[model samples]
Target: MAAAVFLVVVVVGIVSAVVAMSHRSPVVNVLSLVVTLFCVAASYALLGAEFLAAAQILIYAGAILVLFLFVVMLLNAPEEQRPKEPRPFQRAVGLLLALLAGVGGVAVLIGIEVVAPAARVSGDARAIGRLLVGPYIFAFEFISVVLLAALVGALVLVKRKH
Candidate 1:
């Protein structure tokens, strides 16, 4: 049952990601990205990482996706500006590269030995908090700084446009 739910979420996330990347309208792309994020959160939940699932929804789906949509709306970029198709040569090259990468990834996965699951610490919010503050402190601080910079940059850009 959990595996079935995970599979569905994975499929949805893939479709949403493709739609987000291929869409011409910024608004629609942002909406698709939000859907992708939500599906990923659901996948995390199905994997028993409830804390990560909640954080994924709260941070990416709720905050970042909303910010992206707000920026897209504020910019009011015309749909016509988006490229509908790549050059033929670019498309060919991209396809060839994708095929090569996929082949290599499959080979690597097939070569890996299966391992039994190790005993895991309970993944409660408290455990997550401890890990974040201890081992991932630098990453946490770095992300906060990056977000702050992005906010300042957005404000500056909007101010200049007005």
Candidate 2:
């Protein structure tokens, strides 16, 4: 079932993201993050959001992950340094958050009911393109320009001397 597959992919994505954070090696972390991203795309596709799936893969998995890897390599980062034990307060906060998240997840899972959506031209590229180019053209263009500016700003910040 699509619902089951979506649930599995979501679980996998969350696990991979956690694993990515735990990994000491930058390359392994990046790969784990890519796996998480791919899982996200898979879940999107399962939900019939093809455009979102493609955007997830192409933007996060392709561009952003590659950029992270490049930055890692350029910096020649060593294995991540970590304290053997977290501070007591930090550990308590982490535990509290984890417990709250687990409880919330269980509540959501219990509350979920599968229902089919009404038939529609979901993820139709033509329809999306028409909307983007028609009523929302200016907003779309503005967002693109803002994203481009942010990218340039990040590059400038990274290259700047302290």
Candidate 3:
């Protein structure tokens, strides 16, 4: 069923995102991130948001991820080195924090109520464009400026003298 596939894709995305963070090598992390993004695109497709799915793949997975890999290779980032042995106190603190997070997540899940939205085929390109340029125009422009600023900042940082 579509629901089952969507669930699987979302699960894969979440798991890959976590695994990406845990990776020591930057290349592996980026690769896992790509997988996570692809899973997100897959879920968007399952939801019938074909435009969103294409944007996810083209923008995040294609452009942004390629840019990340280019920067990584250009900078020649080294693999992270871990201590051969873990510290007892650090392990205890990590476990405590993880347990606390797990408990908080469970509590939040139990407390939240699900409110389903009315069904609409608002995923069409024309509908999405109209929504973006209509009432949401200011928000859309603001986000574009923010992303542009971020891109400029990233370029500046990457080109900075050591």
Candidate 4:
């Protein structure tokens, strides 16, 4: 039953993500992304990582989706104004990339089944904390600095616009 549910969640996530990517309307895309994120959170819950699941719902579905909506509103993007005909060259390239992605996804699924127990132990917060404070400490600090810069840059942009 768990396996069946997991399969269903995976399918929903994939379908929603594809919708999010392929939609022309910014609002539709953002809502679709939120659905995809919700599916991911549900999958995490089914997999016994309640903390991760909650974080996914709270941080991604709540905060990130709100951020995406804010960006869409701030941009004041126009509605879909697509060309009447799709380019064959671009279609061919897109198909090729999609095929490659499918193959890569399958490989990843198989690899997950064979991953060492130690790698699978990342479901716990302490393990994640250790990773952040250990080998990934530099990356953690770097991202904080980057985020700070981004916030300052956004403030500067707003000030200039006023």
> CA lDDT of each candidate?
0.87, 0.89, 0.90, 0.88
Higher-TM-score candidate of 1 and 2? 1
Q: Model 3: per-residue lDDT, tens digit, 58-161?
A: 99989999989998999899988885787999899999999999999999999999889668565878989989999999999899899999999988987958
Which pairs in model 1 have colliding backbones? none
Model 4's C-alpha root-mean-square deviation from the true structure amounts to 3.8
Note each model's CA RMSD in angstroms. Answer: 2.9, 3.2, 2.9, 3.8
List TM-scores for all candidates, in order.
Answer: 0.79, 0.77, 0.79, 0.70
lDDT of 3 at 24: 90
**What lDDT score is found at residue 13 in candidate 3?**
90
Residue range with the least summed lDDT across 10 consecutive positions in model 1: 153-162
Look at candidate 3 and tell me the lDDT of residue 59: 98
The candidate that achieves the highest lDDT relative to the unseen native structure: 3
Query: What is the per-residue lDDT of model 1 for residues 1-162, given as tens digits with 9 covering 90 to 100?
Result: 877887888899999999999988889999998999899888777667889889999989888889888888888888957457799999999999999999999999999998997766566799888988999999988999998998999778769543
Evaluation by lDDT, superior candidate among 1 and 2: 2
lDDT of 4 by residue, 7-92 (tens): 89899999999999888999999999999998989888876677788889999989989998999999989988876776999899
Task: Assess the local accuracy of residue 53 in candidate 2 as a C-alpha lDDT between 0 and 100.
Answer: 86
